[model samples]
Target: MASSRGGGSQQVIRTGDMEKMSLDQLKAVKEQADIEVNLLQDSLNNIRAATGRLENASAALHDLSLRPQGKKMLVPLTASLYVPGTLDDADKVLVDVGTGYFVEKTMAEGKDYCERKINLLKSNFDQLIEVASKKKTLADEAGLILQAKLKQSSPSS
Candidate 1:
């Protein structure tokens, strides 16, 4: 069987084709399949990271919205340290608009923005998961085919 990946169409080795390929050809095909799996894994990792970030942002915004206005709280100066600060207005927040830009929005608007961004990130994450699963299935099939071919050629068998 064959699959059309982006850029061009490529042949996938089936049980029948695997029986005809030389040992070297089988190894080459296996290597290509491994590469595809690796690329898909990298993409999945990136999406996972983005999803985590969006979730964290959403949590922070929600927590901020619940805090009392004019209350002094510890603001995170670093991962391990927080400086004392006062919440002048729980009604507003600073939001990162990407490309090193930030925008001010009301707390309600900020929550809405977080919800929208989280939804977008989740959608991308789901797509990446689907692609990665397909690539992994392809890699596993290729590995099985290669193993069967190797076994057929073994003298002990």
Candidate 2:
């Protein structure tokens, strides 16, 4: 089968037509499928990284909830810098929602937000896995057909 994917639209030609396509057309199909597979893989990796970060944030929140107010701790300003500071409030925290926006939320609300986001990312990851699997299968089929065509055209010893 030949698949043309454009603007979220997929046009699949029947398998019978693929048998009639020239070598160049088969090669093109294989290449396009390969590109799509790579893109999906990158997306999967990014989702995994984001999920890990959320999990880490949840853990940090749990740890913070344990510390009493006025407890001395080193607050991180960057990867390599931290300043000594005393905890001012134990129940309230600033949550970075996104895009340079921070919102104030209680500890419980912050944890709930993290949980919701984690769940959403996991659901999207699963759906993307299904799509990536289908695209991979299509790429493999295109590759096999291309190889067969190549073998048929070459001289046999």
Candidate 3:
């Protein structure tokens, strides 16, 4: 009896009798499967490397979050003088310790640093995305090759 495969090809193998594939057909199938396996491995490796980079960036962010926000330093004023009128000498010696000002400056610097780091992380993420896209293309090509090989090897219908 004649049987038809899905791709408009006909084969004359009997319905009840199963025939073994030729050595070349078996080798072709094996090769197609190997290509699929290799493509999958490469995709996995790309994903792993991307994940590692993201993890490292996350760790750096965590470290930045844990950093001290700067402490104010106490400055003593020493002056031997007296204001005989209204304000006392101690009151007149109310000096700006400048700690608050310096803290604000330092915080600004830290913010700039964090921004730069975030930009770098974003760039790395973009690179990872590009890598993933390339891997996906490779995987798709491998899948198509396997499908075509399988279709070619199948009994025609």
Q: Give lDDT per model, in order.
A: 0.72, 0.83, 0.43
TM-score of each: 0.76, 0.90, 0.36
Candidate 1 residue lDDT tens string, 37-101: 67756766766786688678878988988888888999986679999999998887888889989
lDDT of 3: 0.43
Q: What ranges in model 3 sit over 4 Å off?
A: 1-105
Candidate 2 lDDT over 72-147, as tens digits, reads 9999887699999999997998888999999999999999999999999899788778877877777787778878
Write one digit per residue (lDDT tens) for candidate 3, span 9-125.
423222122124444544554454455445545555554565565455445445444544342323323245433332212211221223644222232344454456556645655
- Backbone clash pairs in model 3 (N, Cα, C under 3 Å; residues 3+ apart or in different chains), count: 4
Q: Which residues of candidate 2, in runs, are more than 4 Å off?
A: 1-8, 13-17
The per-prediction tally of clashing pairs is 0, 0, 4
C-alpha lDDT (0 to 100) for residue 36 of candidate 1: 69
Model 3 TM-score on a 0 to 1 scale = 0.36
Can you rank all candidates by TM-score, best first?
Answer: 2, 1, 3
Pairs of colliding residues, candidate 3: 4-157, 5-157, 9-156, 9-157
